[model samples]
Target: MRIVVAPDSFGGTLSAREAAEAIAAGWRRAVPGDDVRIVPLADGGTGFAEVLHTALGGTVHTREVVGPLGDPVTGSWLEVDGTAYLECAAACGLHHVGRADRVPGAARSATSYGVGQLLADARSAGVRRIVVGLGGSATTDGGAGMLAALGLVPVDEDGLELPYGGAALATCARLDGDADLGGIEIVAASDVDNPLLGPHGAAAVFGPQKGADDAAVAELDAALGVFAGVLATFAGREVRDEAAAGAAGGLGAALLALGAGVVSGAGLVRELVGLDTELDAAAAGGGPAITGEGSFDWQSLRGKLITAVARGAADRGIPCVVLAGQVSVGRREAAAAGVDSAHGVADEFGLEASMADPAGTLAELAATVAPRWGR
Candidate 1:
């Protein structure tokens, strides 16, 4: 039997590649004769540039840049064939903010300045195109900080630049300075298609995850509205209601203002990683295609990396199995999303053991499930 093992990063515990290798190792342990192929995936989030670098063979460049909370943090970008692949999470992800620091004030103040610095570096390298993976952000500033880093400073009525934070955008009167992209093609790779304003927008939907309270969410939303109005004026068009304009804490809106195109992050990653081709090859033999993430919850049913892999496997008449750290998704929901079976390491080995050894527990779970599906 030929088995395809593909999975996204299990939160911060293991990378996608590590998870894939662990699952493949365990599957081989269960059935030594089986051919296990590993393919890691990402959906424009934390592991975006790393996974793409693995598949595309790019030169990874690292540099110190401004972090989410106005401090310096290490960031990286991948360059290959005149294209730069950048992960927004590297600059301003929620992971940068410690659990203890994840308060409403911090959430309101997180910035994407480092993302602009990365873009500036890519442009300086003369890349013809840039693909920005936009998710896992710790910001809600409507990309005002990013724009500021790119020379487009947001200022108040007193002609003073506003402080770095979403709340300060409420006092923003207009933008000072110009952001010159020099004809580079910019792409916003994102999973969500939410607009930049209103209930389904950036602050309202994602602010709480970054630690914003109800009041902060409302404030950030109103502030983003103000920034969007100014951005529309600068862009000479309206992009506030555009699809995917809310991605990465309205970084998508900023990219839209820069005339960037939006594409599904999962779809792009799937095509880049050649997942369908691998699934077609795996379909020649009879075996299940396994995929997973940190937690198999309602989000998995959306267009996440696992869902993309499952759908690809399903299209090729291969059963899709999930071996996640924790599985909160219902079986019926899993089935509806092309998942044949879903197993959780936490459920099988208890949360304490799984948390202590995520890779080992996940591997054990995969080994336990292999006999039922691998043969």
Candidate 2:
């Protein structure tokens, strides 16, 4: 038997690589004579570059950049075949903000400056194309900091530059485009399809998780409105309501204004990693593909890594099983989402034990479930 194990990172616990390895080990233990293939995956979030590097054998480049809260931090991107793959979360993600700093006050001051710096560094590498993974952002700045880092400073009526963070967008006057992209193509790999403004927009949907209070959410939303309006004027095109324009705290809008194409993160990574070819090869052996993440919820069905993988496997008639830390969706929902089978570690070992050792629990679950797969 041939089994392909592909999974996203289990949140802060097991990374995709670790989860794939553990699942492979368990599958081997259960079916000693079976062939197991591991293909760790990501959805343009925290581990996007890492997973891509693992799959495509890219060179990782690290650089020093500004953090979410105006601090110095080290960030990295992947350089593969003259294209740079950058994960915005590496420099400006909520994960970078310390627990002590995880406050509403901090959200107001978070910036995407590091993301800009990373892009600049990638460009410095002489890469003709740059792919930015837009997720896990800590800021609702409407990408002002990123624009500033790219030589487009936001200034007030007094010609004074606005301070960092989303709150400063209220006083912005105009964007001064000082640097040119010089024909480099930029692609934004976004996780969500939310626009840059309104109830379902960036600030309203993601602000609370970033530590914004009710008032802050409202303030940030309005500020993004101002920012979007200004960006539209600068670009001479309507960009606020573009699909996925609200992704990554309105960073999607910024990328759009810069003429970047917005694409599905999971889908982009899958194609780049040649997932179809791998799945076809595995399918030829009459093997099923197993993929999953930390949770199998409604969001997981919406263009997430697991969903993309499952759909790809399904297209080729390869059964795709999902192994998650927690499976909240029902059998019908899982089936609808193109998942052949869904197993939760918590279901078998209880939530506490599963949370304590998710990797081990996943391994155990894989071993128990392997024999059940169609021979």
TM-score per model over all chains: 0.96, 0.94
lDDT of 2 by residue, 162-189 (tens): 9999888988889976747778999999
Clashes of 2: 1
* lDDT value, residue 355 of candidate 1: 91
Which parts of model 2 have CA positions greater than 4 angstroms off?
A: none
Q: Which candidate number would show the highest lDDT if scored against the true structure?
A: 1
Residue 249 CA error for candidate 2 (Å)?
A: 1.6
How well is each residue in 1-375 modelled by candidate 1, as lDDT tens digits?
889898988888999999999999899999898889998988888899999999999898899999999999999999999999999999998889998888899988999999999999999999999999988899999889889999999999999999999999999999999888999999999867889999889999889989999999999999999999999999999999998899899999999999999888888988999888778778987867999988898866656777888888888888999999999999899999999999999999999999999889888898999999886
lDDT of model 2 at position 161: 89
The most accurate candidate by TM-score is: 1
Tell me the deviation in Å of residue 339 in model 1.
1.7
Poorest 10 consecutive residues by lDDT, candidate 1: 298-307
Candidates in order have lDDT scores of 0.91, 0.88
